[model samples]
Target: MIQHGLPTIDQAWTAQQLERNLSRVLNTGVCNKVLDALKSPNADFQVIAEMLKGDPYVATRVVGIANMVRRRDGVAIQSIQRAVQVLGLRQVSNLMLSVMLTGPLLSAEGQLPRRKDLWRWVIACGVANNYIASQLGQQTDDNPDHLVGGLILGLGAIVLWAGLGQAYHRVLGARLRPMSLNRREMMDLNVIHTQVSLWTLEAMGCPDVMGEGLRALLAGGRDETYLRYRCVEVLGARIAGLDASDASAWLADGLPRLGIDQKHVENDLGVLRSELRQIGKIFEVDLGSWESQQAFHQKIMVESGQALASLIIDHLTMQESLGISES
Candidate 1:
């Protein structure tokens, strides 16, 4: 509607559509059963593992996590039961819930490029958030649940994209031009991804604390419990290839409020980046490749208003507009 031929939907209609989609996904055959099991305090691991074995895609991911845990020892876990044993009951439950929530997007044909990037971003943020939580000595009895909350914080955007389909595709395509996704959503839909994310989390019956943490992050207020975690998410987005200028603003504003010294920011970020790279390997996602880093560096120069940067920006923009390539 604003530009680039993307269709605009009424905000009310978009919300309605998203709710319908979430209901359908949540109430479907195996998914409903899986979600019910995950929410149950007395969920049987053997039953859940058997159910996961039926879904090859979900099973592979479960096995991937197990192997990642044992990667240094070069141990390969083949059976779903064995993988479940390796990951523990709580982790298995969290993984099942995560997979169920993401199943729709992953199953959407012709959206793999975007889906893969979104998955990588979410996982990196989760790992980074965990690192920050550890630094602050915020240990939880259920660490996987805490990590899952961080992983799914950005999921609202993906949920909206899947719910809106071609309408969202147009929005993504427009991202190749001048506008960012948040700005475009604001202009076209009169709402932002964070709002959608909170709605989606609530609809999925996630813990209230998870939604509270996300709300705190978006509001930029200093909640004693969520501030440090939110700062890590901002840093994680930068590490996952968000705009450097945006990250700079987050640091300039949010760091001071969180009582973080400006001098310590760079060293802390370095450690986080190193940790993310290692985590990326375990998760089978490259946090940022050399070429992507170069691209981002050049993009930052353009963002800084360098006179000669326009040509490079235009070239990159054209490539993005014309191709369904990974950023």
Candidate 2:
């Protein structure tokens, strides 16, 4: 069993045991078949990819890959065949298998709060991540994996939302977000989801380097991984076009934990906003649509609150038990 800050588990919540059970499930033959299909020949890519997409676990990965390949390769590609060519057979297979294995990480009995806003943020983050990758020259115009790191960045929150049921709602309502809350409050709200999601991803066969890099990025440290850099890039973009002081304040107070300096952050924010405008033009969406953007930010706050509430409850139980033992 894994030991969190809480006291030893009463024989039921060991990390080792959870890891063993999850590992076995992930290694099963059916899971392997799903992964194999993700790597199938182009003639079979669309059918299999679509089938995989039907599973919630695989949907983001499929979409991420398709987007990466199309954007980087610039091959005027419209199908999965082009995606595979852009991303290559190996990377696609790894992502597909990884997606299938992540299925069991979220418990089945929990109910999530608002999902629409969370999904929109996830998609936005993914888009922002890809744009950063493009700017960094990590991929050409056709590859989709460029944003793979960003799409699943919030998996930890999703896992918590899936695990805590209603306890999450009550606690998040009581604490964590009260208006103009600090970044520490957000972290306090989300730390459990962050840890559990990372552990779950590790157990599901993600390369430790990638998983750890992402964890570090979210946890806010000055790490040097590609994922970390990209996270900073996306975050900077999220608040771009706002007052420079406001954006800088977010960096000064909240984002430094992710290891980016304010100067670089401001610079990246400019680049990303410009790039986003271009992307918006391509998609025919108005990047500077003030009313819509305000609505979107409001929605993100509402949903992020729910996600935070779920995470807080999971950790609070641990904290509560520890407190009782200490008292």
Candidate 3:
């Protein structure tokens, strides 16, 4: 695996400080518009949606969500207006918030052709979380937590990518690709990303549960944290396009503490992987593992890290436009 350069504590602290100063950016137009819609008892849902349309990524996510809702209801939604009518207001508001929070992480760039395979794993995790939760018989109220939870379960990875930035870039270039270290171990050495993420979430006034839960999950073991981590592990492996057998093996030894039934997880792994492949097609992210997957893990780490910074800037700008301050 290639070894990426590790960021010094000072660098990590610098990233944390910069992130702390970003709250002013999050309180802008896009966030306020959504919050405003939520407060509207008789507001025009279409108009609220049109306001959100200013961000292309947000627009695409809302449209996709609207279609997802329509499909769930066995109806055809031909326009944003019709779609919002079908999804209703509260649900739409939640969808918008979810998109806003994650937009930056999802839109980063600089994946080499072969390295692009990692994103498939990320998408797989998202699909697996949704599917696994559904299979577990979660009711409507529980659905939002599960969806957001699944989507952000790998939040630690994003945190590392965003916080470590250039140092992380160097680390990956020096380590993973050069040394062939696996993704999991490579990230653990750079704990700054995780720490900074926890701080960022707290700064944003996210519930203590979200931050604590992420900490425990990333701590890596068979305890409560491990169980939560299971969701991301399964989803991530699937996203990488690994077969269930391979995924099972990877998780079994690496996450024995999770106590989740590997057999049960294996049964649905193929299905989860398939779902991720479909999402990849939708996003134009190729899912196949090229020789790059086996090369150094470090080389591409920087690329991933830098992409996150770009995403943060874009999202902060979006929030600023809405007049909603980050916590």
Candidate 4:
């Protein structure tokens, strides 16, 4: 049994209990059927495609990935088997496994109010990562591994929802995200959600790279891989409005520190949003909210820019009143 009311939203839970209870629930649906086939010694793309036969949602997404990514020709793939072949065995399995990790949690019985938003965040981050990574010529090991990294970026937040239910909602509902979210989780629950998320994914047999990427982020490493993950996370935060001020600061400061071209990413924003919304359809995520947030952020940026200019004018006028001059 999970602990929805282990404590009130503002209260804490013992770290020991969080671990024991969370471990019990991590053997997710992806751990069965499709994931099992992936773990099989003779795992093949055909075997994975067969496992997806009766599930139109998964099949559609398989073909969607084929059309959305693997195919540069914009030719639509209507056949799952052909989609599987185009995606290759490794790519297909990783995509299916990563998406399913947190996707099913959204539709599970007695979902939290914010689970859908979390789902949107996860998928949007993954898609944006793939888009950015591909644009930068990151091969992602010749697979859509960025999808896994994207899901991993805020995975703990979702897992905390599963472990603590509404109690987790306190953190979810807060404006803080990632490390700030981690701070609140530490303050309230005495457990870090990222650690829990990593444990849960490992228990579920997630890919080695998912663990490595997330761990690197946690350690504050500045390697190339870390920069890529960090950029995707910033994009995720902006899209989800998780930490708007921080994301805005990062945006204003420019992304060169993270090795991204701000102007290039800015130019691609339209196409990126479109592609994300299209991917959202596969998972039933309403990304229209993302657009709403986009408008809100832009408005804030304009207002802030105006305010700063006003401050400068005020300072210059005061200097003139005092008879101050540069020379």
Candidate 5:
């Protein structure tokens, strides 16, 4: 059994341990087959359709999403092959990856607090990232692969939570802001989620573009492409009721870098949000009604405050146990 504990910053994560944790999370052979299919050059409709047919649940989801895409027509897509054709290889791949990544978490017995919220945030980021890419008129290397990339980025957090189990829950309950989690995670685990995410993707044989996009998003440097993706991710997190404040600074710095004005970015984001809601339906993610959004926002604020108080208590208890004085 894997031991769960908060490690000091000096503790290093070994390659063997990383592989063991990744295996624990992705134990199924079907997931491996799907990942293999994703990296293949000839990942055409037939290849994906055949692979998806092996898993009834995943196939049903693909058909469901395909039908959702054809909304208002009332047409039933009963065939997985037809569904693949309707959604195209890129989109079909996106849906497949989303299922593979989230299936284990969904079926797990012990529920992680706010796991649904994290998933909702994941779907939003995936959809929003693709939408932002479209708005920019830039063709992504893998087309709609940004959707998968966004989901994989969110998976990093899930991996940490699930791998560390209860100890990680303590970290989550502390309710650090989304961006702040990076620093806190580094201080506690000696490795950030982005690094964990990259390692998992590489270990799983994910495509280069996924790793590239993640690296760019995490390391917000002068790269224009990286900044664009970072902006989209930040916008998606805000929509999911995570952290909205961090995006403003990114936008302030990024828009000028892209040679675009604030009005254009705002207009694009407005259109993107509407598109996101429609896309959210296909992904089955509830970004919430306006009232719900407000309620969620309030809940997050309250929880953050409560978590900070709890953290103070935890810290004082630890200090006292270590014989440290308040001074």
Candidate 6:
């Protein structure tokens, strides 16, 4: 696996400090074992299934993806080994990584509903990114399953919340600002969550492609892989009904040289959405979780104005304390 570390001088928290914080927050005992097994050359379907059996979420999600892929028209796939066979090794690994990170962080407690909303957005993004990759793969006759980019999109937010706890909540709760989420975190926490997420993924021993895909999703480039990553990632949150104007601004720049447009997105995702629904039914995973996301956004608009005003004040005070020049 390729390792990418942040330049130490720019970081508010040193790399070691970030790791120490993440270690306390993420329950990686079972996760490390599972990922290790996934990476082992000797690991087979049965061996992988055995490793995952220890974690309820991983096991259930594995079966869910298997049945989701199967479409449930023939028969339900309940056995772990059978599930692995249906998904193939690579897809199963992708699904497992998707479930583990998204499952834990998005499950955090809150009346703010940010965690729940992020959960919905992240999962839907997994669906959307996979759809876009599949489209590109067909034309080039390459593997079409670039699913991890969408799931990793929220890694920075998840870690910020997990590591900083309520402190991160205050940052996100503040009224919508024109700044990118990265800038917001940099001002307050002296580190970018996406970078934290990238570092965390590297620390966790993720493959080079995942790390590369994340970078592409963040800054974008004209490389085919980067373009595919950007296509779904830039639009995933918007389509998922999350606030992501900062990320979506790329579509207008023509910097990445992407060709797909709004109509293309709606039409393509429409078909993929049906398949996502089928996976939800088969695996009971709620992969296409927009059912409640739209309603959540509506509720936030009506209920959050005054509350956000208070958070904005809190954020300004925090910036003052840290001497983050707002000029």
Clashes of 1: 0
Q: What is the TM-score of each predicted model, taking all chains together?
A: 0.66, 0.50, 0.60, 0.69, 0.67, 0.66
Compared with the true structure, what per-residue lDDT tens digits does model 2 show for residues 23-132?
Answer: 43333454455665654464365555444433322333343345533443433333333444455555676556445433333222433454322333333455566654
- Weakest 10 consecutive residues of candidate 5 by summed lDDT: 317-326
Task: List, residue by residue over 1-327, the lDDT tens digit for candidate 5.
Answer: 222455432113423334454343333466568657766777777777777655544565666566545544655566778778888876776666666565434443365575645555666677667656665775643345666766677666666665565656655554435656666776666667667667666655556776776788667676876877666566666555456567656666765665556566556654544444444434442222322353354344324323322322232321232211213
lDDT of 5: 0.57
Best by TM-score: 4
Candidate 1 off by > 4 Å: 1-28, 38-41, 69-74, 109-119, 140-142, 169-181, 218-220, 256-327
Residue 154 alpha-carbon offset, candidate 1, angstroms: 1.1
**The 10-residue segment with the lowest total lDDT in model 1:** 304-313
Model 3, stretches more than 4 Å misplaced?
A: 1-28, 36-47, 72-74, 88-90, 105-115, 140-145, 162-189, 192-197, 218-225, 242-246, 250-265, 281-327
Model 3 lDDT vs. the true structure? 0.47
Candidate 3 residue lDDT tens string, 1-327? 334465454334534543542232232366656667667788787687666544333444444555543344544344455546656676666555545444334333344232233344445555655665564565533234455555555444454444444444554453223112235334546343445545545544455765554677557566755565564655465445444455556667544454455566667755554444444433332213322353532343323323322332232321232221222
Q: Cα-based RMSD of the predictions, in order? A: 12.3, 14.0, 12.5, 14.5, 13.5, 13.0
In angstroms, the error of model 4 at 227 is 3.7
Candidate maximizing lDDT: 4
In angstroms, how far off is 297's CA in candidate 5?
Answer: 38
Query: What lDDT does each candidate get?
Result: 0.56, 0.42, 0.47, 0.58, 0.57, 0.53
Q: How accurate locally is residue 46 in candidate 5, as Cα lDDT from 0 to 100?
A: 79
